[model samples]
Target: MNRIREIFDIGAGFENIIEWLTEEADWLFDFIALVVEGFLEGVNWLFHFPPALVMIGLFSLLAWRVAGKGVALFTLIGFLLILYMGYWSETMDTLSLVFSAVIFGLLIGLPLGIWASRSDSAWKIMRPVLDFMQTLPAFVYLIPAVLLFKLGPVPGVIATLIFSLPPVVRLTNLGIRQVPLEIREACRAFGATPKQMLIKAEIPVALPTIMAGVNQTIMLALSMVVISGMIGAGGLGNVVLKGITQLKIDMGFEGGICIVILAIFLDRVTQAFTTKDKS
Candidate 1:
């Protein structure tokens, strides 16, 4: 056992690789920082630019439309409660982080998923990568994110994106690949191009599954908010963190309640989308 350990020296090997990457990948880090910053700014603006009341009304209307009156009412009351607790701004910041991560996750995950669905080689490559992403502890993502983006909401968003990305990709690939072979053959027999078959038949059939992925991704992003807060991401996570440090039970309770409310609200809204698609 000692000899095998000495021969392998996995820790040393891992450390060496990390050191090499850090030394050689400065440009890559800068590029990621730029892209993350752009997304962070856009999402932040979207959540922050409008007055809080207007934003609340808009979200309430959206919840009503998507999830029906019950969810809408809950959303209104939840937001009002957060506002009354003086955590409105923090909640908004958390929402911004989540939205930004989801948008980017979808943008990247969907295409990769589609590609993986269409090609055996791509699927093989992505399978292990997705496994690694999904299996790693969520907090581990924050380290690279902080190193690349140097903390703040950008790092938070990046970490959240990494953590939440795999489900969508995996589900999208599953959904598309699960398309009935007979249907695919029929489309080909009808002289449909690959693109047409994909656009008209595969994606539509697969949408429900994809939407489920979206719901999962959003939930994962929300779960990461507090972890991200540790690295200066701010938001309700920060409030919770403060409460933890100061031993303020009331503050912690308020933050926890708000987080739960937001989670339920988002889960319902996204699930509604999936339900609508199925209907």
Candidate 2:
């Protein structure tokens, strides 16, 4: 009883700070949500549909461009797995949710990372916040996401975005920082502007590392999709969640296997793209 009271007292002691931070975060989340909603509406107006067929076609082209015959076939097999499993709609929902999260994470992370790489003070300021974000447990993020975003794919997307954003930020910062001092000096000698240095020197050298960060971000986001389904994010995850609630072993098992298959396929494709060949 005494310990419980002490914990409550401690929490009460920080109530003002907590409340202020919460309010600030709420405003930020609302602003971001509005921006995303606008972008999504614009996309819907242009695409007029889910664009899965477009994605499949693009993936095929990408596979041919990257890994040739074997990878293209693998891409087809992955598509068929979702189709045969009767989870096309669910998969599309998951894709949309993951895509939104990844795009937002990149948009925010890459620029912040580039800026941080430019100054030691900036890196010191941002590093611990990212460390805290990366260290926090997955489920903990979902609580505020649900409270603020109100339980659906939107909240799930926000949670997944927060959960997955750290890697890209950290890696992007590292990648840019690791650019050789001599190369930067050479660029400077050529009278290149900061913008030109970044575009011509930094990003190209950093591309592999940035792609690796993206790969990690995507995998983490996919992992979160199933957990997010608890609050209305739909995918093979919802199938697994249903199986658990109803004690349907086959459904759970099959869904689990499908997730594994999808993960493998994505990892392979992304890795193929990242692993540049030197002749």
RMSD of each: 1.6, 3.2
Q: Tell me each candidate's TM-score.
A: 0.94, 0.86
lDDT of 1 by residue, 17-130 (tens): 766767799788778778878878887888889988888899899999999999999999988888888888889899988998999999999999999998999999999998
Q: What range of 10 consecutive residues in model 1 has the weakest lDDT sum?
A: 14-23
Q: Give the distance in Å from residue 208's predicted Cα in candidate 1 to where it truly belongs.
A: 0.6
Worst 10 residues of 2 by lDDT: 39-48
Query: Global lDDT for candidate 2?
Result: 0.79
The residue-by-residue lDDT of candidate 2 on 1-279, one tens digit each, is 998898678656656555665677878767867876665445434433646566667766778787678878877777777667777666666666777788888999898889888989999999999998889889988877776777777787888988998888888988898889999999999999999999999988888888888889889988987789999877777989999999999889878877876676667777776776211
Model 1's alpha-carbon lDDT is 0.90
* lDDT accuracy of residue 247 in candidate 2: 100
Give the per-residue Cα lDDT of candidate 1 at 187. Answer: 98
